[model samples]
Target: MELMILLSLIGAVCSADITAFGQFMISRPIFCGPLFGYILGDIYTGLWLGLIVEMMWINAIPMGVSVPVDLTMMTILSVVWSCTAFQGCQEAAIFALALAIPFAYLYSEVDLGGRLFNTKIMHWIEKGIEQGKEYRITQGIFIGLFLFILRAGIAYFVFFIVGGIIFKQVYSFLPYEVVYGLKKAWYYLPVFGFGAVMYNFRNIKIPFLRK
Candidate 1:
């Protein structure tokens, strides 16, 4: 229970950084995964997994007027589920990650909505400034952070409870071979993520690198 609560809180704080404050790159999987993994007592696999996902997603970051994929969300959910479920079984880890993609996509929708909601709050903040409400800046920032944490915390709580129960039931029915196949993918999934990230970075013409 302590581990679950501790990691869940860390997940919320790191996830908040995905858009809230200190874009010190904590939102990246390379940092987020291992960090959470460490909190849950398995930093090594978490780091490698983080590296794989980080590399694969090196191309999908948000650009002006362009919404990027929810890479951080997936990394966090995957790490949390992997750490919680099977106590570090490499094979089970792969399927947990595979299953998490849809949840990440679902989170993307809710995240977009939250940002849009923030826009309205921003407008109110602007009005408050016009009216000399000097505290609105702090108020607005607090609201943004609060909403972000609330959302992430709730999502983690829900997914952890439900995923834990359902995945256990699902895993019980799977044959050993199927489990091994997933473990094999665990070794390869990182490769896929790394390749995707590298491909995304392909356009960068480094100086004197045969441009």
Candidate 2:
């Protein structure tokens, strides 16, 4: 449990880095999933989860002021729940992904609010500039970044606990038919994910198909 908590916090920081500081691709599930998995001592599970999420959300890009749902948080929460709560159950992993989507949307709202608050910080820096205090620029950046990490960390920590409990309980009550379906989806969903990825990258058209 402690290890899972730590991994969730780390996941929050790395995910935040994508937009907050680094803007590196590390926020993508391809990187984020395996990271939490590795930290939790289950790299393959993480790899599968990451691949599924990356493909499923291949088109989730932030354009203009529109914030997409937080895929990174989804990946982290799903992976953590699967690894810790279910521990290598493919059906549980799929269920975990299903469970994480709503939470991801919640985080998206949080992210939007955070950005709005950062704009206020930007105003403070602008005012400081007029007063010849150049240090406010650095101060604002540091403060914004700290808040970003804190917000993400806290969200992950809370969700990891609550989500894990819910995941275990909900999964335990699932009927055998539902569990069987989830198991099948565990393999079949990836094919759909890959197809979605390929379609996004290069829409392959059949020769006989009418455009």
Highest TM-score scorer: 2
Model 1 segments beyond 4 Å from truth?
A: 200-211
Q: What's the TM-score of each model vs. the native?
A: 0.86, 0.91
To one decimal, what is the Cα RMSD in angstroms of model 1 from the true structure?
Answer: 2.4
lDDT of 1 by residue, 1-211 (tens): 6666666677778777766777677889899989878877888767866787787777666767666767776787777777877667776666666666787788778878888999998999999999999799999999988998888777776777777677677877989899978878877776777677567656787788774
- Over 13-39, each residue of candidate 2 has an lDDT whose tens digit, in order, gives 887766787788889999999988888
- In candidate 1, residue 87 scores what lDDT? 62
Looking at model 1, residue 99 earns an lDDT score of 67
The 10 consecutive residues of candidate 2 with the worst lDDT sum are 1-10
- The per-candidate count of clashes, in order, stands at 4, 0
Error of 2 at 77 (Å): 0.4
